[model samples]
Target: MKKVSCIFIVDDDPITVFGIKKMLKSVASCDDIQIFQNGHEAHEAIKERLKEGKIIPEVVFLDINMPIMDGWEFLDELIALDIKEHITINMITSSIDPLDYKKWNGFKNRCPYTLNFKNKPIFKIEANDLGCMDIAS
Candidate 1:
């Protein structure tokens, strides 16, 4: 397992973000952790970082349901950017709709960076299962 340099949590749910952050802190060694309320904000920030030649997040936890922009929309925007960085995206959503899964599979096919499609409320065990280790060590 490799320690992630940076991580992004793109979800409108504060509780979900908090839980994920706490779990990440406990299980993974990440240098930077960024939180965005929606996909739109995350997308914009990523573009800005790219423009400024700054390091983008290596991993992203995205939620499918959001006010401004949904996870799928975010993935579309990200693919459009064609960023060269090796980013791994995990789809974390509460949606039980089968369509969501289908869409996620389609996105995974289109975007090689996508890693896992997980249900909401991520826990420390899930993080460990994802193989998050301190690569810096």
Candidate 2:
């Protein structure tokens, strides 16, 4: 399997983005990770990259509960732009509300690029966590 290079993380907190990038580096999962303090910046950056014919991120870590442009708002804008055909978006939130889970589930179906959902403050990326399945017969 080919290793992914580009990573785009969107969140309102700078510290959170720093922590996520640090953790990913600690695990050596990726060498290049882009950080955006807000969804508006992330969206604009992604759009520019798309126009430049650059490959989008294989993994996106999104945080909910942001100002001006929350995760869902960003998702809507992303869908409207239609530049995430090959990208996988993973919701990384701290909320434990059942409704949040339900919304993500529904969004996964409604959105074209949403791949999965998970809580934020992640420290590791397990093979199983990335949706790798074993097939034996």
Candidate 3:
């Protein structure tokens, strides 16, 4: 699999975070994995990295409903930042609301980089598939 420099898991659910982390370990070669409990924290961290001219995480697993700031809010804030790098945001969620899919479709079109949608507890195969996410870039 292609190596990744960094990854971020933005979710408030501990169990989901744990599961995703473990799955990622088995499927990818990323060495840096940062976990954020809320979108507010994640956004702030990203800002700090950008200020330092550091590479923003190449991949982010974002959940829709989180305290302090939801996934949509985080995405909005992130896209507004002056980032020059490519980011792959995987919308991992348990919400089955049809509205979420509609929202995702709209968001996907609006996103500047790769944006994918998936259910909670991402599978190993899907995680492994991320190796090719940067191919076109």
Candidate 4:
């Protein structure tokens, strides 16, 4: 039951962010949750934190399509920064487009740290969804 110090959720949709934050509280006690409307703003915030030598989020949920900068572009910027290691990032977009899935899968293959693709309402904080992994005391 380790608490996540910070959780960064980057999506253009406000409602989606609200739902995800609400669900997260049930799993781990997050000290702070930063919600950004677009990839650019999210990326900027991350960089700012890094500059201040602050602890980054334990998890980041990114959306695919967005204004100013999309998820793909943010990934490129991230790599260009020679990001050796960072928190686990999961694509949480609702896009069912084949191309989007293909890109996501490829990235997963390249960077296994980039975890599973979870559609909306499938936040990783569910206990029942833990299935066999849920050990019985």
lDDT (0 to 1) per candidate: 0.81, 0.74, 0.84, 0.72
Q: Give the winner by TM-score.
A: 3
Better of 1 and 2 by lDDT: 1
> What lDDT is reached at residue 25 by model 1?
72
Mind giving the per-residue lDDT tens digits that candidate 1 earns over 1-137? 34678888999989998888877776668778899999999999999999999898888988889988998899999999999877878888888899999988888788957468888555553543333434423
**Compared with the true structure, what per-residue lDDT tens digits does model 4 show for residues 1-137?**
54667778889888888878778777767778899888899888878887898876667778878999998887776655555554667777777788988887777776635455777666456432212124422
Q: Which candidate tops lDDT?
A: 3
Q: Which scores better on lDDT, 2 or 4? A: 2
Judge candidate 3 at residue 41 and give its lDDT.
95
* lDDT, residue 113, model 1: 72
Candidates in descending TM-score order: 3, 1, 4, 2
Q: Candidate 2 on 1-137: residue-level lDDT in tens? A: 32556878888787878777766664336556788877888888888988999877777888988877888888888888876356667788889999989888888887876467778657765443333324211
Which regions of candidate 3 fall more than 4 Å away from where they truly are?
A: 125-137
Q: Which residue pairs collide, candidate 4?
A: none
- Candidate 4: list runs displaced more than 4 Å: 123-137
lDDT of 1 at 92: 89
| Candidate number with the higher TM-score (1 or 3) | 3
Deviation of model 1 at 11, angstroms:
0.6
